[model samples]
Target: MTQFEALFDGRSFAAILFDMDGTLLSSIEAAERVWTRWAAQFGIDARTFLHGIHGQRAVDSVRQLNIPGVDPVAEAHAITLAEIEDVEGVHPIPGAREFVSTLPEGRWAIVTSAPRALAVRRLAAAGLKPPSVFITAEDIPRGKPDPACYQLAARQLGWTADDCVVFEDAAAGIRAGEAAGAPVVVITATHQRPMDTRHPTYVDYNALGATIRPDGRLQIRSQSTRKI
Candidate 1:
């Protein structure tokens, strides 16, 4: 009787969409390892560098670092390759298997900024195989915060954006869902900053124990709880 099970006792959602990196799989450690190695190559403090781009895309993160003479695209590519090679400590999120297993096959897909090859490698490392309809960075012209990924996912799932519930841990991902006209259930797995909880389409679930209802609502049963 975990808190999430209690909270999600009676709810129904049409379809569920998940974000791969932090929400469904714990890839932060792998990401940190790769990024730190890349930063060290430039004599930068890995910890400090990681903090500056914690929730951003690899390319965006590289740009922000403003490394003296390094090309952002090249740096991002290098980091991506390193991450693919060193995907240790990556595993499925708690309750991920059970939650995903309960959902109808083909009713959900992973939408992530990771390119196809890397995404596959990470999921494999996590011991989780995604369904057939995943939408990776390679599948979309734009990634999170652009709405393209979510929209494409919804389309592939044969559902309208309004009928899908997006699970994400990043602000950019939430915004992407909102932009795509989908309801977003945010899992606080990584970002520590306070999120804007006022938006009608946004809701936060305590990652300690949370579940997506069949109806698409997120239920989090903890001592302190409130509905969005």
Candidate 2:
């Protein structure tokens, strides 16, 4: 079998965890528009700053800037509000809806840095249904790169981090998954160019599918010849 097809060969996972934004859907345009506006308000270069913010909690990303006189919490809240109000261009990644539909109910969760409200709005805008075990920024004390959110998501699904597979698209989320002891699948849907990663990577869910074995184990199958 090809490397892509061999990804989950001879293995089974108790659950699957996914990062919302760039993993299952694309909100790039809407997010960039709002962030650029916010950056302008703070006199920061939006283009350069956007690189460090994806996959991180807004407050954490803002706090890291350490901009004088800026309240990260308040600014993050404002950003979230703007994002929620602007769903223009929000849409599911290729094959996202079909792939998600193949999974068993209650065996998957969406772990996102977005606040619950924003997550819901984005999912709705993308025409995807929110999973039963949705874990959002408000549900965890820490965000991506911290592993708290992934761990919490695994726990909520009655599984350990190691028993679940994480689908991520950003550096922070990849680190979070590794730190949480979950194997990660890198989704490159939102990437501008190829990313150097050790994990199995895919451009989108177009070449993937999942099925429940008779033994009650979830098996992921990939048909693409894409490098992994």
TM-score of each: 0.78, 0.96
- Candidate 1 TM-score to native: 0.78
Residue-level lDDT of model 2, residues 21-136, one tens digit each, is: 99999998999999999999878899988888889889998999899999999999999999999999999999999998989888999999999999999999999999999999
Candidate 1 backbone clash number: 5
Evaluated with lDDT, which candidate comes out highest? 2
The ten-residue window of minimal lDDT in model 1 covers: 199-208
Q: lDDT of candidate 2?
A: 0.91
* Model 1 lDDT on a 0 to 1 scale: 0.71
Candidate 2: where is the Cα deviation over 4 Å? none
The Cα RMSD in angstroms, rounded to one decimal, for candidate 2 relative to the true structure is: 1.3
Error of 2 at 53 (Å): 1.3
Q: Give a tens-digit lDDT track for model 1, residues 1-228.
A: 433344244544456778888778878888887877777788888887665454346887888777788898877887788888998898877767766765667778888888778889989998888788898876776657899888888889888777777778777787888898876666654555555643322223322344555655444333443333
Off by over 4 Å in 1: 1-12, 52-56, 191-228
